[model samples]
Target: MVLVTAPLIGFSGEIIWPIGQILLPVKIGDAEHSTSTWMNFVVVRSPSLYNEIIGRPGVRKIQAVPSTAHRMLKFPVLGGILTLRKQTIAIGSTLIEEGWRALCGLLRRNLDIFALKLEDMTGFSRHIAEHRLNVREGCSLVRQKKRSQAPKRNKAIQEEVEKLVDAGLMKEVHYHS
Candidate 1:
């Protein structure tokens, strides 16, 4: 009897890890069958592995099943039959490939929310208050406190303030009243 040894690999949290393994003897179009046509497994350690196997000819479905029975079984231990269930399958490369770019873009967009400007307390507070007003109208006390410091402004400072206001980080208020 010829036994094939499968390598053990780890799936890191949220990070796409790629792996190279033998292509399972499953065809991509065989997912419609009722029997276990999509039972084969591919060990992955990176995102490229997903790209490699998903484009192959004979590959049917690439799914991620939880590595342990402890995840699925909820009965008094032996009550549930020991069986493997397919959790989710990798569909295409759009989400996997461009995922990092999406995350970085989100971080850059919200960078002002996390930044603190001690020198420009009034402007910083106005920015924070305006953002809070736009997002949560009930939070007014914090914003009022932030706008208490009335400091002198210059052209460069005014430009920076206008930039934040234009970017939706601060509210534009006219001093007509």
Candidate 2:
């Protein structure tokens, strides 16, 4: 997820939003099918507030089965080999599997995506805030009073931020009156 979010920086060169750093496992199938296909799984992640803040959205369909007793019905594996269930087939040169192609195209055609490295920026301008606090004293480790920055961003930068917000890459935070 972090690898994915690394490229979502807007025109101002800041991360659109933070994302979960991991992909979650999705289990498939229910009681009747469970015994037959026990090892089904998918690499998936839940859409979060950050994802909403950004442009991408996702949905999950869970396979839920009610409690029921199974009789003696069972499935038997028929293949000694070449079974689809156990076979790991590699789909060659598809969009996802061939990231190099997509990256090359992006580099050649839309360099702006690479130009604004979100990870290099200090912060984002939209749906965001920053607070500075001082630490001091012997063993106190207490935080000093916070200092607030000007609520208004530069007009040009704000315009860029608005563009990203309009594109559904960020939420409008109403922290200021």
Candidate 3:
């Protein structure tokens, strides 16, 4: 990889010179359902809350749709749609609290507002808001070929899926041909 000085603007309106750039293969989702794409990552010397940030190009390559309201990311896979859910809530770093007690009391009082666990979820709805994917004229949906897995891996996958079904996070559905 060749070293290049790339200037990037920060969120705070500060200009930064990147240390280097490298092309890497980034894969998202699990083994059964996933997509891979080669991305050019710019190494920077700065402090950030996030470890790595995938810009719009990387997301477009994976064809992922992220929803802040739903707190999840969805994308098309071989068999069906793959969804990734956010487990933790984001707290503003600028938030001022009197002390730990005040912060704890505030969170305690609003415990019902956040879904901290599977048990905290009240219900599930397929339709949260109106959303549509615009397909270009004459463009066709590409069918992905299913990859075969080892017997042990398949059994482990099935067990993990059953756990999700039991937790009300996933359910088996029969699609009519």
Model 2: residues with Cα > 4 Å off, grouped in runs: 1-43, 46-97, 116-123, 126-177
Model 3, clash count? Answer: 0
List the candidate numbers ranked by TM-score, top first.
3, 2, 1
Error of 2 at 176 (Å): 26
The estimated TM-scores of all candidates read 0.16, 0.19, 0.47
**Best by the lDDT measure:** 3
Q: Model 2: which residue pairs collide? A: none
Top candidate when judged by TM-score against the true structure: 3
| Each model's lDDT | 0.35, 0.32, 0.65
lDDT of 2 by residue, 1-177 (tens): 334334344322333443434444432223223212222222124332232221112111222222112111122223321101111111123234346555566557744223243233332322222222333444445456965545564664577667645644446543221
TM-score of candidate 2 relative to the true fold: 0.19
lDDT of residue 3 for candidate 2: 40
Ranking by lDDT: 3, 1, 2
Backbone steric clashes in candidate 1, count = 8
Task: Report lDDT (Cα) of residue 161, candidate 1.
Answer: 72
Better of 1 and 3 by TM-score: 3
